[model samples]
Target: MQSKIEKHVMLTKKLALSAVIALSLSACGSGGSDDAPSAPRVQNITYEALPAMLTFNEGETVRLSLNTKGEGASGLKFNWTVKYLNQDVTFTGQGSDTISFKAPNVDMHSTMQVSVKLDEANSTKTFGFHDQHLSLSIKDLNPPTTPAHELGEEVSEIDTSVLTTGSTWTETHKQNSRIDQVDSSYNLVDSTLIRSFIVESADQNKQVVGTNYCGFPDLNSMELNASVLSIKCSSGTSSTQYFQKENSFSIVQKCDETIVGVSTFEKKSNEAIASFGSLNMQFKNFADLQTKEVCAVVATSKVTAHSADNQEVAKEEATAIRLVTQQEGNDFELHFAFNEAPNGFFVSLNSFFDENNKATIISGSYPELNASSQSGSLDLDAKNSISNMKGTFNFVLKNDAGLNEAVEGDFELVLE
Candidate 1:
């Protein structure tokens, strides 16, 4: 009985193993097929056209054609539309891919947009439709006429003997020249003269002052006996300017064939020197020379002031001075350091002088010394007609603690 039972159990185990092998093969086959077909890919649409930008005149005819590029493109349906000034107009088959039409008349200028769309004949309303566009501008065909003479070629000449050297001339205008002083001596080699002028201009209704110097070159060869005189000037660079004078007054000044300024002047006086003055400087906080006379070099282009005792101050920093003079009443207010004054810790001063050689300091300040409260006064004694000057300055500076510190000194300057 034991052998029979054991044999029956072994047969049952063999049957179970056969069932497991069949189930394994079924799962492998149900997973996937290696040769299964893939989903269809989307089609790409492209085209080529001649004359990408089209321009036509009114009443003219134009022909435009498009050649499509894609798979199964020839089998696709085509729709052509033209839009102009918010209106859309549809065109029918001109053999499917070509358009030939006459441009409409336009009063001034007009633009037309032409487009073509391609799709399957039985396609449903959907996104991703393919289309191409072309822009056409139509206008009246009118060309500009040739000018009589090139601009700047039509200029006249004048006599130069009327302009006298060493004479001062004056003109009154809103933002032009007020006075011009010519040097007494002329540079014979280059036929030029040193000219200085005071100019005032309105910038946003605020007066702006500027001083200009130019080497006025002779243009006598160009001016024969005409009413207009033509003279040239150099800007100390690669620039050369031309000025035309009619009846002893400047009518036009040009550079690079462009007019820059126009003005008229009347002879003011024969006085050579416009105005002259001296400068004095001292520092209370720093130890150097207590006080010193300033040496000045004056020229048409610039005026430079420096300490006569170079050991006291460096040459570069001591020579930072610019002179500007304004004729107000009987006094010439000499503005020193104008826009070139050193900021933060440096002191700048301005003085005024009268015809009698009297001098006074109008303003003085040390920018960084006193941030809150600062007051100063200058006492000036004029030595001679601006050739020499002596002055003393007293300043009281108050810090945040309201503690007042006094700065006092004196100086002398002579023109060289």
Candidate 2:
């Protein structure tokens, strides 16, 4: 009987211990709930009227709408304010959730701070008031008044009919000049040079006469059309030049002055070359002692020529041709040859000249016969006190075997 009584006492103690643990857990789970209702969670608070970030021009209106996701938001009140240009301005919105105002004008780029306050304690069960802020960029909208001329706009084609033989045109102006020295690796060393000059041209035989500062060899011939006036000039080879009628009819001489015509030549010519093939070449040289540091190789050639019958004699897909030049002490030599000679009739022009002198074609034959003759001129222009140089080439290929070809072109290369 005593053993049974002890067993009953142990069971009673275990039951009391379990009951104490259960009470402790219940108190921990509802520590503050027994006194008052728990605070409601606030979430998804955001603006619906304006974007997170805003951009506007001065005098533009901006609108804002406030939104929230949770219970007890009906009694919330919103107070709006804007801080602009070091001053703060408060706004009254009649207890509405939306705010609207005009952006203030600013002299330059500026920013404004817009903020809203929500009275959550008075209107909802949330812990306290909520604050939201946004940044707005206000930009000046006035247009810029610089850049007097519109670039890349097509102008009217020049009327070349009135440009009769012996007719002369002249102009003078200022322009920005750029000089670039490139190394063999195509790295460029550049400088800006100020240049000025006077230019005059006559229609007869297309002779161009001007001061040494603006000298261009006399044009061998000129062709006029409804939209373009193409001029062919020879210095060492043949140079076929074109001017768009509708563009800036201003003639640029020695890459210096840009001349505008005081009087317009309104006559148009019916005869014009249909097409001229393209020429491509490149020049590579080193600008300094740096290895692999090379100047931009000038490898560009384009020519549009028509036969006497006005038929296109040159096609875009013809065999490639190039003009290469090398410096030999105080003299320079230029070679013109086909990348792939059409036949044994390969024609080449080897011209050499010194500084401040015209290039003379020394040797080259078309038919490889004694009667074959070749002649051409290369006129070098030292621009910006020898900062750079440009040369014009005009060559005539004549063979006793009935082959005759005239080539004219120009190239610009760095002096250094």
**Which of the numbered candidates is closest to the native, going by highest TM-score?**
2
TM-score of each: 0.25, 0.26
As a TM-score, model 2 comes out at 0.26
Q: State the lDDT of candidate 1 residue by residue for 1-416, as single tens digits.
A: 12222221221111011111100000001233558754322244344543434677767876776654555445445667775544554454643656767776643334566776654441342234435567676754542211223212222332233334444444311111111112111111101111233222212222122222211222212122221223332211112222334323333443223232333334344443443333333434532232121223221111121122111221111111223322122111122221111221323332232111111222223223422114554454534212244556555545576545455555454431
TM-score of 1: 0.25
Q: Give residue 109's lDDT in candidate 2 (0 to 100).
A: 39
* Candidate 1 wrong stretches, greater than 4 Å: 1-46, 49-52, 69-74, 88-95, 119-129, 143-416
Distance (Å) between predicted and true CA of 128, model 2? Answer: 11
User: Any residue pairs clashing in model 1, and if so which?
Assistant: 157-228, 158-228, 293-412
Q: Residues 1-416, candidate 2: write the lDDT tens digits.
A: 12222221221111011111100000011225567865544433333433445677778887766653334344456767776644664444636677777887754334567776655443443333335567776765652222224322223333334344432332222222111111101111111121111222334233333221212224333233221222121111222222334312332222111111111222122222111112222222111111111111111112222332233444211111122222222212233322121221322333232111112222132122112116554444434122233445566545566645455655443312
- lDDT per model, in order? 0.34, 0.33
Candidate 1 global Cα RMSD? 30.5
Candidate 2's C-alpha runs over 4 A off are 1-50, 68-71, 90-95, 120-124, 127-130, 147-416
